[model samples]
Target chain A: MPPTPRRGASAVLLPRLGSLVVLIAGWQAAAWFAGSRLLPGPAAVAAGIGEALVHGEMAMHLSATLARVAAAFALAMAFGTSLGYAMGRSDRFDRVADPWLVLLLNLPALVVIVLAYVWFGLTEAAAVGAVALNKIPNTVVVVREGARALDPGLDEVARAYRFGTWKRLRHVVLPQLGPYLAAAARSGLSLVWKIVLVVELLGRSNGVGFEIGTYFQLFDVRMILAYALAFVVIMLLVETLVLQPVERRAGRWRQRHA
Target chain B: MLELDIRRKEYRGVSSPLLAVRDLKLCLEAGRFGAVLGESGCGKSTALRILAGLDPDYEGEVRRPGEGRLGIVFQEPRLLPWRTVEQNVRLALPQPLEGRDLAPLFASLGLAEHRDRHPGELSLGLARRAALARAFAVEPDLLLLDEPFVSLDPATAGRLRGELADLVARSRATTLMVTHDEEEALALADTVFVLSPRPARLLGEVTLDRPRGARDAGWVAERRREIERLRAG
Candidate 1:
């Protein structure tokens, strides 16, 4: 237990940073053996990233992808949470919506994207809609579980205190479901961002996915790696900056079991 | 004033429809404190729920002056575990504090220090105190408490009972409490309504003639015996 990790700046970062450095070194060595064309090294990819930012369409493509992710993530979470809460609280609603939920959850993402394009004629709405449609069912399932586990006694107290629908939702229901909503958001962000790529590749243009698709046809490995790496780094920043903070805030009331 | 006339209340059970309350009638005039004393599972809580408007399927009528305003303490401290103690109490008020200072209420209940703590961080006794604070925050015209003191150690229960008695006397809300503890009923209530076993009806009643201040231990013991005799008769 010499390296017993305590909560501090160094303790958390040291191990993760160590492993990541090792991974990059390993990849660099592999690239040297394979030659730069087949599997480019870290330096080549880094140079390619610098090149894209300086003289390429990286900004426009990155913004397009980011906007789609933000729009679709917000849309899915709002609609799914309401639907899930309704299903969880009402047996009749569950019965009516269960089959539909099952169908949507099992539907493949590629199929949804293709169907949306066919129906909407390859518009921006079609791309975001397809991505959100793929995501809504997952959010519904998680939030439904959260709603079902809610305490009946608390509901009684809310009713007795004469809390209006909106008040009860904010003070009573939302706090109870905060963790669930966070769970949905975390998963939805990952899913929506990845699917947005496939969506852009399939029908839409002017996104990271479209650029990657163009490079794939031209057989440009370095540019492809650069775009993919940049997107992954952006997502990592979001996970740290946005989602993690929200999850922590939502669980602030949890008591440590002695 | 508050009135309840629960002719019948039934629950859909496995074997058959289980009757929980029948022919149970209670009336507490404005500014009076009343207790319903009954055996365990004698449907006392069902009667209280009907009165609090928490249960709607009961076959009866409940008449109170204000329909929307209510203050209740359930058998368990049904606090929103995520909220701080003060937030739980404040949420029960007709408005957010209603422009009245709650510092006195918080101080008198010995919860001034613990007001910002969540219910999850509290012991049962402290949670019960928070529950009592919530019930009294509204200065409710009718206060319904369903065994608010159950499951606490005797010392904490007694302390809470004392604080409750003081608050009830000062607030003068028409209070109705349900409990199986006979002495507790005798100690605090102006009228203790004794109830029979299942599908409960009124077996008898013991009414105290003195104000709460004069009702010492000796007097409470005497009334307890009187209630026993009345129940036997």
Candidate 2:
């Protein structure tokens, strides 16, 4: 109802840049008052990351964490999408499966990770399984909503024209589902990576999360910040480079038409 | 060739089971145009759906061409908005329409230039025509149009009707269209089957002996009066 000013790249960039500057300044001020060993500022953390990359084994830990995140993401998305679609399309299936879905969704991430380790006895499978189990419920809930919103009219058209399984899914079903899948992937990737960190910290011995846990025991905040920052940067890269492109491509039609 | 004999079709309702169609018999020989005429929500679409084989729960025996060669134009275009016009039509036939030229079909429907564009970019009339193109592209032995031109402006609907009439006549496909408009039924179909309200049964049949697209306003009015008199009796 009210006038909103026109926005360009600068409109978005300026506010975000301003906020980051303020955040960094506040962190630097806190580091100045606190001892550098306990509360390292941005420069010391950046130097710590450089030393780890050059002298220590940061890449191996980073790769391990990335691999775990990828595996858990793939597992969750594949299983969740199929389950969600089934639940969405059939009321009977949703009625039967909804309580389990609700229970899984509400179950704490920490509990799943701990139980998985307890049951599987501290292996790679347990770590990946725990992260996937935690992420699957969210993916199912999001994708089920996508499925429920599917166009029945198009479905009839597909049926009346006798679209074969492959052809119908590729052209009709998938195109309609693109946005939803993209949304699920974006959110699911973030959630899976976070849970992967928790899984790694709790069980695995060679990931960014494990490095952070080890540094925490020795009270080396600089190294802890270094590994966490490196991991966060890698995740940001994955989000921007991989997932954002997919989400953009998925929603390209709507933006172009709108 | 097509044949439909739906003894009864019912839908579950909140309070009671709602009857849709019963004792509705229809037959169309090869290269004929048939229409089911009824009031809005008078189980016309249910009958068409049964004929389309989308509604199999009905107690009926429907005989039509094999499923693969059937084409349907729903009330809405139902075009995948993400796909281009040409892709939508091309997808119906996995193998290309063997030795068939769709250039003329596209030209006749005025979709030639818009073939590479999405449905979202087109007007409703154009979208409907695109739907017609998709159906006709299959070179179907049987074509179904469910209230295809109902929601258009008179000019758009009229133009689309002419395009459809021309397309269907050229193809000589056994076409069955359902509509509430008697004018549309008379304009398109050779034999029109009038259906009664809920639990719709065939009330009567009016065979328009005149050739399609040749039955002008005057002839239509004359036949309409006769049909009205028949209904009154």
Candidate 3:
């Protein structure tokens, strides 16, 4: 191929146009072969999505699901970073926490969610807590390793200068751990959201996960596809608009520092 | 003055103690620069760690003056990868220094503009300079340096030595450095102590009465040969 399109023509516009063309072609073919009930043609699914939007059901569902994911992700970030930092800093802390981490990390997410629901009686707290608990162990493992890998020379220099705890954290610890934390956060968000969906499907009644289960029971394939499409689009939007920017900045830091 | 008395260190999985500095009593005078020169694994780095209060598990007693602080510069710049040059330098400073202290330190080390740049962005020379600034910023009573300029080009190392010597002279900080480089040991130190290999024992100490920054190439060269012979044996 001749050098791929440059700047204005190739970089921004072409890929999106190609994707649109492929999507439309796929939709028309599916609609023709599968008929509307088992697989709503693309146009029908789009119409169902519009209908869901106007009726406000999709918005309510999306907001509910998002609230659960956000709550769990926040909890994971706060607890994971602190616990990981502590474990990394002291061998005593590491020894005490290490076994518990292994236990939690190996346990199945479904088992925890089911147990949490049984214990807490299917409340929203149980749902969110399940997701948070599922994520913490994994995040802790990542952050701990990052912290452990810090250059001892940096710590010695910190001591020589007599840096206080807060200064050392800001200058030495945080920067060293930033990329690792970012990676943890990104991966955590993806995992926690999926886990939250499972939690909602099993125990909660108002989120996207609940809606998917509800539609599936009624054999409403169009509704199922609509909700699934909405989720995929939302995920793509978040990765592109949010997680990727942070990852890029951290990656640039790693390129220079590591 | 600071002193170390008969230090011994043993590592795991070794047949015997890895380093034994027998009767290693030495008093580094206040406001004087000294070098500990020996071959690799000669316990020189280990000695600097003891003086810096890093390795406290050893058997000997290390007595540093209580009034003045101690600053250490490692063989590596050891700047935190995630930190900017300014941040790395600031790591040792208790709090941000005001006017005279901050400005002079950065300018002296030629790191004024590169302050906001991270260690990843710096050249080997610049990183070492930042390390130098970090040491100076501590404003220590005693400065312990473990060949902090080992990776720099000759010109850069020479310039840094001059700047560091000047800084030590101005601050009147007692200094102890360990270096395998004979010329670096001769150029920067007022007193040089040579150590025997492995089970390190202090063989002899040479005192240089030359004024700071005044030693000519010939004088440094002559001392370098003597130290080289001492190390070679």
All candidates: DockQ = 0.69, 0.70, 0.64
Q: Tens digits of per-residue lDDT for model 1 on A94-187?
A: 9999999999999999999998999898899999999999999999999999999998899999898888898899988998899899888988
lDDT by residue (tens digit), candidate 2, B1-233: 68889998999899999999989998888788998888889998998888877877988798885442688888888898888898888877646564466788899999889988888888899999999998988888889889999889999999888888888878957999999998999998889888887878888888998988478889999878866765565
Number of the top DockQ candidate: 2
Docking class of 2: medium
DockQ of 3: 0.64
**How does each model score on lDDT?**
0.89, 0.87, 0.82
Ranking by DockQ: 2, 1, 3
lDDT (tens digit, per residue) of candidate 2 on A182-243 = 88898888888888888889989989889889998999999998898888889888988988
Model 3, stretches more than 4 Å misplaced?
A1-13, A20-24, A87-99, A252-258, B14-17, B66-68, B96-101, B213-233
Give the C-alpha miss distance for residue A178 in model 2, angstroms. 2.6
What does the lDDT come to for candidate 1?
0.89
Candidate 2 stretches with Cα past 4 Å from truth are A1-12, B66-68, B96-101
Q: List the TM values for chain B, per candidate.
A: 0.94, 0.93, 0.89
Question: Which scores better on TM-score, 1 or 2?
Answer: 1
Best model per lDDT = 1
